[model samples]
Target: MLRKKKITFVINYFYPDLAATSQLMTELTGYLQKDFTITVIAAQPGYAGENHQSKKLFEEGYVETIKVVRIKLPEVNKNSKVSRLKYISSYFFLANIALLKEKGTDVIFTISQPPVLGGLIGTIGKLLKRSKHVYSIHDFNPEQAQAVAYTNNQSVFKIAKIIDKLNCSYADQVLVVGEDMAETLRGRFEDETVPNYTVISNWTDEDAIVPIEKSEPAIRGFLETHGLKDKFIVMYSGNLGLYYDLENLIQVADKFREQPDIVFLFIGEGAVKERIQRYAAEKNLENVKFLPYQPKEFLKYSLNSADVHLVVNQKGIKGVSVPSKIYGVMAAGKPVLGVLEQGSEVQRLIFESGAGVVIEPQNYEGVIHAIHYLHSLDPGELKSMGLKGRAYLEENLTRATSINKYRQVLQAVADNSPLEHTFQPKQYKEVVHKK
Candidate 1:
């Protein structure tokens, strides 16, 4: 019998956490387990305040074949910038220590979790274990920090920029979540030594998140539980973070406050959750509702509960980040109202899939117009659009499609074979980063 190559993953969150990164890593590790002896070095999952028992080895049956090393670190309030910085610095130091403990591995894959710190740690893991490093840029660093105004200090930005550049050059392959991200990276790292990018859009489990009819028990029960039965729900599920333009969304919700049948739902957690709730309260907006992240098993119901799902990005975040929640919305067979920059990847996807409408950022009137247009559609016509989205998702963004691409990349990198490169850094002089 042939031995499988060893591949270690270094990330901040893993399985138990419902954060987008956690879900993506969990699925990736699970899918690659048969081909690679997987090892995950992650923090004790608590980004969303869900407590998990500390374990040095993630030998739990979640992914029975892989080995997981969970590092112990002080809990910090995510709302506090000082506390988050403390946590990031601590994790960077301790995670490197954990990586140094691992033995021979063929490749080390890491995501941009603590931004550039995670990628830098992957380099250390590669050097210590004598393995190749594959840097997965889930979201761009320094740029993402700047997008959200996470830090105004020039020194911090400079250090992040330097580390980011080093990680780009150090990795054997640079994996990005979207095409614009690939273009952006290729433009930034013009040096030939910098790793080539392969675009791998985030995916959803088709079988698990199949379209649910309103008559389905799961959907019915969810609506009943939330007192949303017979209401036309416009839901924005997943992270309510800094990069999202929710001010206009809130205003849109306020516009429908007098209409008893129109309910705006905001699900999941993030920095902006409380602000959203408070704003809705201040306006006495009775049409809006907020819910915490639902368990994975019940996600289909929560996701499908919305009549028209929303996916939003702020003005200037086109290439720097892509919201993963849109995939789930597509999987649920629901029409989307994408509030994003014009000509963005999200707008393109939504239009291409025929699943939703796109509105420019901060366009409160556009938001109102979109909701009314969707509301004006025949139920059957809306269902047809949703069905188109689900079909598009299955054909283009299914887990199998995504994981197969990853498998090929890993195999090619492992064997020193040529990758089916998607973007060449030298071809483009500038990448789009506009509002």
Candidate 2:
């Protein structure tokens, strides 16, 4: 039997951690384990919850073949920019110490987590392991920092740009989650020798999150537990963080305070979560609810509890970030009301799938108008829109589709051969689902 090539992933967090990036890395490594002897070097869990022991080599129950190695770093919550950087820098400092102990790897996969530092660590890991490197951009670094006004240091920005450029230039294959992001990457290194790049989008496990009737016991029970039963639920699930203009949605909820049936639910934690909570409480908005993220197993019920889903992005964040929750909402067969920029990839998906309505960011009136329009729709019509979204998700954004792309890329890089398949961006007109 041919031995499987080894591929070690260097990330800040991994399985048992609920971060979007952590869960994504878990899913990717889990799926890739069949073809690769998978190993993950991650931080001792800190971002979301309690810390687990920094075990040397622990096997993941879900994927028995994969091994995880955790590193100890300063425990810091991402509550502020300075604190966040401290968290990132500590990981960069300690993770290198951890990587020196790693060997016998064919490829090193790292994401933009500790910002540009994660890629730099991956580059170093590649050299130490004597393996090809694959740098995956989860979010653009210093640009994202600047977009959110996290820092105003020109010196810091210059340093970040240099690190980012080096990571891209050093990697054997560069991976981005969306086409808009790919365009952003191209723009970043326009004058330099461009690296091999591909758009392998984050995906949803369709089988796990399929449509369930609101009448279903699990779905109804979740709504009841949240005091959301029989309400026209407008849910904004996922991280309530920077680069998401959720303030506009909260304002819209205030406008609908008199409407007892309309409830605005914000799920997940982040830097702005407390601020939003305070704002809603000060306004005495009884129809609004905030909940922590549900376990992955309960996502199907939690997601199906919504009558319509909300996806919001901050202005000027088209390519800088992409909301990973959209695909899960799509898998749940739910219509979305996206408050995003015109050319954003989310807007493009909504328009193409006839899955939802797209309103520009920070448009409070537009948010109210969209809610009213969706509420006015016949039940059958709304269900049909959701059906269209699920169809598109299966065809384009399924886990199988994305994993296949990664498998092929890893295989090509392992064999030192040219990638056989590449997906290009195409334009499609907005499809309006007419009754």
Who wins the TM-score comparison?
2
Query: What lDDT would each prediction earn against the true structure?
Result: 0.81, 0.83
Q: Clashing residue pairs, candidate 1?
A: none
TM-score of each: 0.92, 0.93
Candidate 2 lDDT score relative to the true structure: 0.83
RMSD of each: 3.9, 4.7
- Residue ranges of candidate 1 with Cα displaced over 4 Å: 55-62, 190-194, 420-435
Model 1 local distance difference test score: 0.81
- Ten contiguous residues with the weakest lDDT in model 2: 426-435
| Residue-level lDDT for 360 in candidate 1 | 86
Clashing pairs in 2: none
Model 1: per-residue lDDT, tens digit, 1-435? 977888878888987877888988899998899988898888888877788765443322335787888777777866788888899998899888777777877888888889899899988777667788888998888988787677789898888888888888878888887777876787676664446667777888889998888899978988998899999999998887888877556877877877889999998888778888999999998889999989989999888888899899987788888899888999989998898876666777788788888988878798899999998899999988888889878777778877887888887777777764432223223322211
